[model samples]
Target: MQSFLQVKHVIDYSKMTHIHLRDFYASLNKKPQPERVKMLLNYLIEDQRRIEKILSTFEAVSEPYILDSWMQYVSNVDIHGLINNQKIKADISLDEITELAVKFGEVLVNFYREAATKTDLEKVSNIFKNLAEMEVKDNLKQARAALFEEM
Candidate 1:
């Protein structure tokens, strides 16, 4: 916790940007409707675009490794791959998948921040911090929507 707080000082994160980062992964499961799947994909694409824009914005920076790494993570996700082999006729509840995503979020949030702090370049550290914050905000949006769906 202390490490994250310390590392977070490297970048300016938009706390107001509530993104639904987890929804796309969660929608891969059997619980969400097909439309939900579409929504997830759209959000995912939007995030990708955001990352790209951020990268382009800082292309002139001396060290953009952190932004590069984040783009790799986003680009590496197998979007077409199905998350579950079993075909369920019913929609899977948000509760079923949120926990897994939240757990991943917790780990990633810490990992990126720690990684940033270890970087020698200030620009790299700042990008990592931004990436971490973006991930958190995006994931939280999904978690929130899921909770709303539950209600």
Candidate 2:
């Protein structure tokens, strides 16, 4: 019989996700132009929304820290998407932008898969599945396109 001791250790996306998410948001902050800032901010807002949803779905015990961190990150973002009618931003090259996005997505997936192998908890397993799906949905394809110069 298979034991429930199949708990898997998840990949520590804490540092990586934080770093990449910060970079994406900071990319907007670095934009001196109001228009570019506004454009990127819109994308940031959407990402914040997605992150919130992801956090909510996580089956972790300490919800407060996770939620707080996500909230703080989103809250500090400048939301001026409405102010700029002609916003176009660029910090990373288009190719680089896609590459990083996809790489991060892959890391997320790998983290979940690794965690699943290390933990026996069904909840943790579910969490990994959800997290993996979220990452796959986000930026994996963009990275692939960027990597292959297909886009």
Candidate 3:
């Protein structure tokens, strides 16, 4: 079994992911882009903030035993590599932005799902499962918003 330190590391990593993603979207928003792209970026920024808050709640509400429990495995996703490859010019198209957003969502969803499977504790597993579900829903919402903007 992994040590409790590993569990803390995983939680910290998840929080860091959201923070980095939020900052990335914010940075993209600072550049001159079409209104549609700006709107999408704004939505993404807020979504990351919401998810980060939810993760914070998990830390606050979970029992000490749950938080201290060892995880079967920790996620090994390279968040930096994923974010670094998403560079776009100021004239980036709506499709390009949408594609990037989808990629970001997919990575988080997969990470959370994998994390859920690696935890034996029911509370910890459910936390990751719920996060995955939320990310999927957010992705769909963002896609619909982008589609509507195209019309």
Candidate 4:
């Protein structure tokens, strides 16, 4: 049986995700293919919107000082590994890009869900649970969009 330990580790992945999305967006922006660039720009915009939602959640329950400190703890985490293992390129098909984006969302959901389960504080757990649920909803929206594109 697994034991629940009182771990006070709170990771703020907002900065990391922003940087990752910016880097990916920049790469896509440089591509010669207009259609691909447009597709990725749309993806990036939606990603930014979702990140804002997560940040808003934190704002609702956390002080500026605590949130600032949590942001600084990004170095302690291997966040890039959690997002996606694939190197995104502009040449990739829309389906491939969608798959990669979905994978990133999945990782976010899994990370938050795990954190929610591991935390000793109800408030912290609930925050993480909410984040996970948001990610799930975002994934469903992406799936629906993909389905529409297929039709």
Candidate 5:
């Protein structure tokens, strides 16, 4: 089996995001709130697909460093630690899951927003802006839906 650093070295940002998300969502599978898990699962799956699309776009680009730099920048974010260190129990509430999901999206938004502002390349900046917009829109939609559902 590959070492942790070895596995990390081979995976790009999108893949890393996928791994983290999949693990987090899986943690909810055995929780008491099946309905909440089902609801969030839909979004998580869609999020992974969207990331794959973004990665494909990056693969088609001339400047390979754009994707690399974006990935490196995101890796520096603390969301990974938050997710990995979180302790989820079978009794965890939907509100807890919703909060974590919101924070997850916020981290992505911040990363992309920062990238958009920092990059000199218009292509890179546009990609980052688009991603940031997408993340914010989804986060808002999810939060509103969860609020209504909880009521």
Candidate 6:
């Protein structure tokens, strides 16, 4: 069984991943790019910021018992490796950037799903499931917005 600390560590890592992604998008925005691409980058940066805030709120308001709960299993998701694998370039195409953002969201969704299933506690499981759902919805919205921009 994994300790509560382990779960907290994963949550912290996820939060940090969003920060890194936000910074990456912000850097891309600073570079010379098509106006549409710049707009997309701005949306992505704001989305990441929103997600980071949500995670921070969860950390702040979670009950002590819920935070201390143990998990029966934990997946071996390599979040650090996933973050490091991003190959963003200043000259990246609009489609490429959109796809990359979707990929990042998908990774988080999978991670949350796995974490949800590994826990026996209903509250903990629900929290993870809810997070996964949020990511899925956000990804779809982002993809749709990009499609409209392309059209």
User: Model 1, 1-151: lDDT tens per residue?
Assistant: 2222222222322211112333344345334365654454444446545754664455545344443433211212221232233234345444655564565456556656766667566766676687789778967886776565555
Q: Where does candidate 2 have its weakest 10-residue lDDT segment?
A: 70-79
Off by over 4 Å in 5: 1-11, 57-76
* Per-residue accuracy of model 3 over 54-99 as CA lDDT, tens digit each: 8888788877777777876644668656887677468777788788
Model 3: residues with Cα > 4 Å off, grouped in runs? 1-5
Q: Backbone clashes per model, in order? A: 4, 12, 0, 0, 0, 0
- Please report the TM-score between candidate 5 and the true structure: 0.70
TM-score of each: 0.48, 0.50, 0.87, 0.69, 0.70, 0.88
**After TM-score superposition, what is the CA distance of residue 26 in candidate 3 from its true location, in Å?**
1.2
- List the candidate numbers ranked by TM-score, top first: 6, 3, 5, 4, 2, 1
Q: RMSDs, each prediction?
A: 9.2, 11.9, 2.7, 5.7, 5.2, 2.6
Residue-level lDDT of model 4, residues 1-151, one tens digit each, is 1122322234335445756765675566566655644555576666666676667665667755443322111233345654445565657665775686687777678767776765455766676788789778978877666655545
lDDT by residue (70-128, candidate 2, tens digit) is 11011121112212222336444444444444555565566555544444445555655
Candidate 2: which stretches are off by over 4 Å?
A: 1-20, 32-45, 56-91, 140-151
Q: Write the number of the candidate with greater lDDT, choosing between 4 and 5.
A: 5
lDDT: the better of candidates 2 and 3: 3
Ranking of models by lDDT = 6, 3, 5, 4, 1, 2
Clashes of 3: 0
Pairs that clash in candidate 3: none
| Distance from true location, Cα of 112 in model 5, Å | 1.0
Better of 3 and 5 by TM-score: 3
Angstrom error at residue 4, model 5: 18
Across residues 7-106, which tens digit of lDDT does each residue of candidate 6 receive?
5665777798899889888888888889899989989999999999999999899887776777754546665566677665678788998888888888
